[model samples]
Target: MKHIKRFIALFFIAAVLSGCKEDMVTVSYPEYTKAFRNPMKGFREYFGPGEDKIRAEYPYPYGSMTKEYMQWNMIEDDSSDGIDKIIAYSNHRWKGVEDINMKVILRVLLVWVEPWHGGKAKDPNNPDDLNGWHWPKGISPQVSPYKQIPGSVGAYVDPKDKTTPIIGGYFDPAFPERVAKLVEKIGQAWDNDPRVAYVEMGIIGEWGEHHDPDLSTYWPPHDEPEHVANRTWVPGMEKVLGDAFTKAFKNKKVMVRYAYEFKDYEFGIYWDSWSQPQEQVRGYEEMKKLGDRWKTQPIGGEITWNWGDLAKFKSFEQVVADKHTREYTIEQIRNLHCNHLGGITWANFNDPEFRKNAEILQKAMGYRFILSDFTYPSEIKNEKPLNISFKVVNTGSSPFYYNWPVEVSLLDAKTHQKVWSKTLDNVNISDWMPGDDWTIEKEAYQKPAPINEIKSSISIDKSLPDGEYIIALSVLDPAGMLPSLRFANENYFEGGYHPMGYIGVNKKPGKAMIDKSLFYDIQSDKTLRYNLNNN
Candidate 1:
């Protein structure tokens, strides 16, 4: 009888332990099927002052911003004008951009060269034939002294007309000071603006690319002793502009044309000739030397198909269609950890094969966060600390670059409406890093992305009611506390939140109430929406 009693007691203890184990649940979510557009990453479109709408034949399926080249002359034509005019001009340029749910990557350029207007006529002698070199009212070649080249000749003389001189302000002593003032004024207007995504530290060279007069082969080579000096970047110019931009814009990320420049500053790189075969020296190799800089600063640029070796591919479609080139391009993007790209803005995505390939490329460019696992207790007592944990993985080439807030909420089981929500203070989404060191042979990152495990204990709201609720998670953009980033998970709800499992508040946990069928139905109207004044 004593042995029987001991056996029964041991059995009861074992059963209790089993019951306790069942109270905690660990759920694993599958990755989503398709790639979708997110803010501040992926391909970008071209935008200008009058162009308010995207004009692609088949609009990009995965982009969120427009790259606008803001001519310096357009913003501040006269040095005597007050800063108000510059502010007003910028505000007007982005007036309708927010309505389309897009941001602007602004580049304030001093020159634009031929084909695109901002300058004097190609035939400088003929005022009737206008071109794209836009020198401001007080800073024209006619007024400023050109000392970079000998004999008082301009640094960039017209190829067609040797007599006509196209001056770059880099050699002028007054140019840097004027640019500093302009940058300061721009910062005051755009640093806090929500519409602006990133600012290219432009103000030198043509198209703000930082290569002209000095490094340009655009005109016939002038090998004369005086012109030889012109084939180099202006001394101390990088530091001057780098310091100005760093001091001026505290909130926004700034990018320069090359990674080799601005070594002292923590500026990003915008490689104008991304993926070009011939750019191995100064472009591709230079960016590769930056090492892990892309982890913090954005690495973006246009894959030019109109010029260089890229033009040999004929069209953007062919560039990605050929297996060798396509693989090489993807390898470069992953290796460099590119955040955004252009050149595909004008690509015709009407072709099914091209569209499919483009989708793969889009997913490879920016941060694609995946919530692989979520664990929580079945029951939570009101006013008690509720401990929950989750694991995230970024499979894309680059990080999100911003430390946005992650929100946890309890939704009404019946209506799928949020009953209670709290933004998790512990999770820094930007630190959820992607993989690195891509290898073409393996077609994968040498170091696979690690699972970012986030464990947090949150306070449960004290309420009188006791009922079942569906637990959910979301990432807010902070612009309006709206859910803007969607996780690449199969458990995603239509309203930008991912529904985990069911839980009970101040009661015994009920059966799992998360109906996968209702996932498609809009649960809330307060979805991911963007507006200029949201900041």
Candidate 2:
């Protein structure tokens, strides 16, 4: 009679297993865990406050920030010594400045203003300002205080021959190789430098003043070729700079800044700004030709107009309010193949204006965020087999789409003997909005799979002794694996973790109790069970 009853139960289990294939469509799932014995279901709890779990689960080694802005705003002085502090700050935030690894290019300019030097070289009140450096007065720059060193200093040089004719008293020569070497030197000095990891060397010598051609008396007369003794953007400037970069950075990548106004040359073409549809398309063609040049799209004047209307630019706040302008700027950036873009020194950082601008830029560029929420169970108790659940969310506006692998290991609480373990694929969530939720549970006796409801079961043996034990749950983005969700900000629903629950672990003893939860709630007897003797 006992044997007949056992056969009946085995037949029923087979029937249920066969029916699962048909319901597979009704209940869609990506993948489930291997089977275990009597996995349990627990109450859904709200995630606690703070980022402790997230930090432990997904610590970020590097962070992204604006370099041009950090230098211009944070570093009050551009002195070599002053630079050390900036490096220190970067290291503190991102573990180490070098840990914030990303590609970058360095550009420098060397200008010679000899004729304007003479007595004007020394500061009037300081007397010892120049330490007695001097040059003739009449030939000097007519712009007063121009002789005074520009506060914004990186690398400057006095030409080899002071007597050499100075164009508009501003003989800023191209020193592509020299500038590249200097940047390399500075980058090496940092204890942990990010730029050094991917720094290219090149210089853009405008020769003329910032935007006005009148500042330099040399350019206007040069149309006749012989009339002006000096010229800017020499024919081979691009190649010369490119060679310097290759030599300095070795195997590293190169980028170039866009400063040369295409309008200056009659036969040549240039865009007023990157936003010009036709010009942008053509400009990239020309820029790519330079190959490995550090490229920076010009923002024009105090700020560029197509970027947004600055008429009401009383504060940085007003500038960011215009969404169209922000989107347009990002579009141009994408068109330029500048996914890892930078170079804006917003007058404000936290103001709504800047936040709006930063939001779109960050979303488009895909900046990684420090993990905000993560959790792994401390312990699970159920004879040999146990069930547990886990959750992950992106608390910040920044998206979270990386892998979070789950690992379960059973260990003897007293002697700490290894019992068993089940590994699952990294939990890749396609989307986790500001406020979202997900829950999962499964059984412990069945092989883990997409439809697995059980993890594993421990049968009591006469030779084994047992009391209390520990089950560990760990979440990680296993090394060498990219989450199933590859793109930066895309949302996936069919196969990834969604705000709604999908997978589950059943703690009930038999298959009957397992499927029962789907229809009715038998919270009392449905609980997982363990016996000290035999199964």
Q: What is the TM-score of each candidate against the true structure?
A: 0.84, 0.37
Q: Which stretches of candidate 1 lie over 4 Å from their true place?
A: 1-22, 48-53, 56-59, 80-83, 114-131, 142-168, 214-232, 462-464, 508-510, 521-527
Candidate 2 per-residue lDDT, tens place, 395-491, comes to 2222222223444444444343445545554343323322211111221112211211222233222222324333333332232121112111111
Worst 10 residues of 1 by lDDT: 216-225
Q: After superposition, how far is residue 426 of candidate 1 from its true place, in Å?
A: 1.2
Q: Model 2: residues >4 Å from true position, as ranges?
A: 1-63, 68-202, 206-230, 234-237, 258-317, 340-354, 366-535
- Global CA lDDT computed for model 1: 0.74
Q: Between which residue pairs do clashes occur in model 1?
A: 118-132, 118-133, 118-134, 119-132, 119-133, 119-134, 214-230, 214-231
lDDT agreement of model 2 with the native: 0.29
Residue 272 of model 1, lDDT score: 79
Q: Please report, in order, the local distance difference test score of every candidate based on alpha carbons.
A: 0.74, 0.29
